[model samples]
Target chain A: MAEPLFDRIALIGIGLIGSSLARVIRRERLARRIAIATRSPETLERARALGLGDAYSLDAAEAVQDADLVIVSVPVGASGSVAEQIAGTLKPGAILTDAGSTKGSVIRAMAPFVPEGVHFIPGHPIAGTEHSGPDAGFAELFEQRWCILTPLPDTDPQALARLTNFWERCGSKVDIMDAEHHDMVLAIVSHLPHIIAYNIVGTADDLETVTKSEVIKYSASGFRDFTRLAASDPTMWRDVCLHNREAILEMLARFSEDLSALRRAIRWGDGEALFALFARTRDIRRSIIEAGQEVDAPDFGRHVVAHHPQTPQPEEG
Target chain B: MAEPLFDRIALIGIGLIGSSLARVIRRERLARRIAIATRSPETLERARALGLGDAYSLDAAEAVQDADLVIVSVPVGASGSVAEQIAGTLKPGAILTDAGSTKGSVIRAMAPFVPEGVHFIPGHPIAGTEHSGPDAGFAELFEQRWCILTPLPDTDPQALARLTNFWERCGSKVDIMDAEHHDMVLAIVSHLPHIIAYNIVGTADDLETVTKSEVIKYSASGFRDFTRLAASDPTMWRDVCLHNREAILEMLARFSEDLSALRRAIRWGDGEALFALFARTRDIRRSIIEAGQEVDAPDFGRHVVAHHPQTPQPEEG
Candidate 1:
């Protein structure tokens, strides 16, 4: 429909985010040629079989060579290594970006290796599923979701605009913030939620009074929601916890403190306090729904769509 | 299509669960006459406006008079009082049931006032959305979900059979569980999850570094899932916490212990432990999906189905 955003786009570590981007780029004709690369040859083979890109390679450097755009979609911990591997081969004018969850760490890891003319923009697409791997991706993952870019102080405006344009074309609403703020924001919204989910699910899994079978059977109540987050890529979350240590720990401390207060309120049977907190949080969900950030459907219609996509979407009333 | 399950059905407490049951019963033609009673007159008026019941009243006793089936769908704390109010008026062969979240509490609270020939079956439909009130209900909320009944020893088999048949007709698979065992099972599966969600969301809302705006904006990352559970009816959850104290506290102890272990692993950077726990939880999610308990779409298809359901259920992918 329009000219390709870049002549050649290199995508490193093609997992859910990477594959989704590849699909959107292909569907929207956002790139002239695509080079898909990952450390795992099996994943590479899968990507090629899916015909996600024009070229597939295990060599990150080879994938970025002569490419106008390089998007790193690996776990946050791998960003530094991938950047190191591709820094030398990246074209002088290439724009380098990432879709890692944590921002400060990604910038620290990739900033040192960028060539003089290469635009190194750190970003995190505030979208994903518990499922991973290339096959789990779809073209519409980014639609109406936020794409946060944490640009450096001296970052080129032209490169920033181009990258923002690319993401917008791929169906994301873009926002730029400082790297530190991004990490702090995500730590509370994403990292803390995942860590807490993993913790709670682990707690339930280890319970002897209530067997795991019971937990799994009645998960629809609320426990299943935590399981989805807990089921996220362990490697990615671990890296996020470690890399975004300060912000996460800060959030964790606040969370623990607030939870202690709640525990006390419950112990004392303080209905008023509990009611106030619960009521306040209800408004937040209303805001989220009104803002179009969440759906009102039970289980978000994911189960229905996944297993019964051919079936008509059920009416609410 | 068939004879109504009950000549007249009375529902006390017109909240999310109550209203949903009313809608389902009406849709399935399970009751010829629906009489709704609630503690709050405001709620009664809302239920009337929603046309949730054929007759609306504030007096539980009056509502249950001459009714063949009376369902108390109030918070567990009010179950005893509602039972006391209606016990004298319940018809000789009427079925008295409740849709409380906690089975043991409901049974204990209402069992004392049960009339000789009337059946008091404690039931819980393991289905809901975060939203509460009459406006939040729909006829299809119970479709393909589980409705658990914890019948006391010596309970009338005929009454149980009729209630089970009614739930089945409303599109729910029914299961019978021992009251105490049901409490323990739901502690981990439902109660504990809600507690954790409320705790984490409260935690996020109280953070000094991460503003509430940030939490709401980037909630799609993972935090939003917790909000759904946290946004649940406060009175319902608070009553659950107070009524199911022992089971909830026991589960909380186990959760805290497990969390300590996870905290240790994170502190020591034990990637293996983190990875193992994370991997194990993933299987639970897979099982949930296979069990048709969870939606399979990425991020719960919240964005795609944000619009109020107007069409027939879309073909499930």
Candidate 2:
């Protein structure tokens, strides 16, 4: 195989994204050594136990010392502190990046702490499962997903190219754009969907007329799909919501506005309008499937035989 | 395997749900003979070509002649007309049921036309994929899903028991409830989730700032989950919104109210509130998985490799 891209790579925050990166880096031989760090000694120990890296450290600063590349994969809200911890320890030519969901907020929080000559590129990979922690990751997590890099204007060309090449090696195609644009795109694509999911699940939980058992029993129709997104890491989603507030609010405004019109159509019994709206969305799913972002598996390939509560339950009125 | 449940079962409407019932009936030998009917000759021909039934016709009345069980699986809006057509030909001791999504409306539309001695039960098999038409169905579509039956006050117990047995044989747990309560429960569990999904996909489709291609390219982040529900058959969902309007409207009102509160919490950067809301939803997903309502597969088992637009595209100011 080709020579390793970096002498040593430091991964700060050994969560889902961080651990996945470490696995892929090791599998693809992208780095000579992997140094993993997280704030909690318990989590650090777990990473060490998993043999996820060449070395493990609880101190973020200590992990980055002498590393040729540093990737911060914490929640967006914690990016600034992580940058501060590692800024003094970063090697002069090391490429620094983050796997945050929001670009603008991450840049605002981390840029000031990024020491001179250490390249700081902000990136958000459009990939993940609803699971978190070190064990929830896999080497194939980045396959067929987009990794977006929002490099600052003054960043060195070679550093950007190297960072792009690293993500490409990790099994993602790279797209380069401005930080502000990346945030706007993600606000609608990622943040709003998670918020809507959480809101709907909350609504179902708070229902007075329908029992919670009923919702749980009948969720396969559609509600269960939302629950997967809502089941995502709480800290990561909360940070995304707080960090990407304005864009999310704007999307929410548009969403509610559209929902009101749909409600009116339903109230007025306008089948034509409802049909048109529903029909328009079918092509989008088709397009997504064709674009390979989604599988066309019927029922999302959920053919797992369900084991359920014994039933043939009859209710006499 | 011992003996079929019915001498001859007539299926009205050969779409997704109807066709699936035919396949399952044939597979499990739930009926000695299956007769299929559709309003459109084209669809009926498609069903015949698929060899889904023992006989097929475009006449709803003719299909039900001498049938031991007749199932109307049309959209809720067409339930009344199917009931009208088959009323004159129904066998006195036969069970009459529908696989509609909305129980209350189906009961209202078909109850008045039921022959004096025939049992009229409304039910919904809480299972489906995004695809529609005869070709989109399989015998296992209802496997491990809930099939809810709402029998009228004076309905015969033997017929209800037979219908319950039929669905159970077809691989579903059976629940019995009144039509009104069924509608209320489904409004939160099924209807609202589909409406929300359609609304969000519509919102993403109409964005001025975000390119449609960009949305499709980056959809795996979270938006693609909604697209599956949004891509559901338009005619079926439109009828559902119209037929179950009251319960749906009430649910929509609740959803909007909860969303507004979530918006407020996000706007003010209430990390604690945001975390609480996000954390609260994770358990619902876990509960659904435990209830056998969802597959606990990571990324919904979406390990399909994606073919994509050639990229390494960079945008510079």
Cα error, residue A23 of model 2, in Å, equals 0.4
Model 1 has a clash total of 19
Query: Which portions of model 1 miss their true places by more than 4 Å?
Result: A298-310, A313-317, B306-317
- Model 2 — TM-score against the truth? 0.96
TM-score computed on alpha carbons, candidate 1: 0.93
TM-scores, in order shown? 0.93, 0.96
Instruction: List, residue by residue over B48-111, the lDDT tens digit for candidate 2.
Output: 8999999888899999999999998888999999999999999999899999999888877888
Residues A1-317, candidate 2: write the lDDT tens digits: 99999999999999889999999999999999999999898899989988999989888899999999999999999999999888888999889999999989999999999988899988888889898889887888898899999999998999999999999999999999998888889988889999999999999999989998999999988889899999998999999999998999999999999999999999999999999999899988999999889977677657432332232111110
DockQ of 2: 0.48
Give the number of the best model, judged by TM-score. 2
Scored against the true structure, residue B95 in model 1 reaches a CA lDDT of: 90
Which candidate number maximizes lDDT? 2
Q: How well does candidate 1 score on lDDT at residue B194? A: 87
True-vs-predicted CA distance for residue B186, candidate 2, Å: 0.7
